[model samples]
Target: GLNTADLPAKVLANRALLCSELGLADQRIAAAHQVHGARLRCWELDEHPPRFGSGAERSRIEEADGHLTHAGGLGLLVLVADCFPVALSGGGQVAMLHCGWRGVAAGILERAAQEFDASPVAFVGPGIGRCCFEVGDEVRARFGDVPEAASGRMLDLRAVIEARLLAVGVRAFEHLDLCTSCRSDLFFSHRRDGGVTGRQAAVAWLD
Candidate 1:
């Protein structure tokens, strides 16, 4: 339970422990405060350095929904409760994105795909699926052109994400269609829990 909602003191400790267990040294992990926007942060090993986790200098970088790096062994982390955590990799670079509906609509995945030198492979991790994501007409309208994205206000965010990535030249994709709202035994769902819930971590790195 890597809770990103800034709870008690033990939350940071939990994150530190998880990083150690995953072999990602505290100083070598990078994270960001997700703003549900399409902002992307590009990191160069030498210029950006590592910037998150439980060390002295560790800090979540600026507000961004996506983080990309060419540095191997440096983990890029994103926390999600019901939002999708999408990982993209190709051409010696990797990116981890916190793709909530707002971020997807803002073209976050497309931006990440364009950053790659070649067509990147994508892994769309678990999130609230259309089966449980009943939204209002306004939200559903955002994805009007994506055939599979909406069904009578039930927003299929994953479909929208896939369509966007494909439009941006991403050729390969793996999707874990687990719905966070329905799989209560395995995931924490904000909507299911009425807006208060823990988060799961999605970490990506090369090597």
Candidate 2:
């Protein structure tokens, strides 16, 4: 499929093609217009069915950086290139978050944690690693208390997120150590590609 971040006609065509190929044509897939914020949206099965692939339906999907739902059959999706895609699931509900530096700084993970019925299990996906995600002093200042926030100028987002997960009481946590910028053959990187690149998706659903 094409970059999940783009919803142009071609991207939509690619999405439809990919869905058909994956036997997901009948699935209700929800997506959001990510603004690198900490906004989270909740979904109900009948009232908030996913609207991601079609032109008309796409217009109605909300603009948010994260999604949570206890409903089965609805897939919460997040698009990422260099940013981490985190999934939290437990107690019958699930949340998928697009965790970039800005979103994380804005407490996106903490916000998602509050929606779970129990202490959720967390899975942090591939993203730009510390070796590649170098940031300036200003960005690092935002995470002043995070011990793993930076090594000199290199930012370790996984470390930042892991620390927060622990603080939020999520113990059963796992993180994919892969770096998007380092593994060009397997993933895309907004920084590595100079801001013009495709995106991979992280999706979660019940049942």
lDDT of model 1 at position 98: 96
lDDT of 1 by residue, 1-207 (tens): 333455545777877787888897777777776889999888787654443554444353567888899998888888898999999999999999999989998889888888888999999999999999999877878888796778886888989899899898888999999999999999989899987888888999999
The per-prediction CA RMSD against the true structure, in angstroms, equals 2.2, 2.3
Identify the leading candidate in terms of lDDT.
2
Per-residue error for 185 in candidate 1, Å, reads 0.6
> What TM-score does candidate 1 reach?
0.92
What are the per-residue Cα lDDT tens digits for candidate 2 across 91-196?
9999999999999999999999988767999999999999999899999999987965789989999999999888999999888889999999999799999988
Model 2 residue 169 lDDT score: 92
Worst 10 residues of 1 by lDDT: 51-60
- lDDT for each candidate structure: 0.84, 0.85
Error of 1 at 134 (Å): 1.2
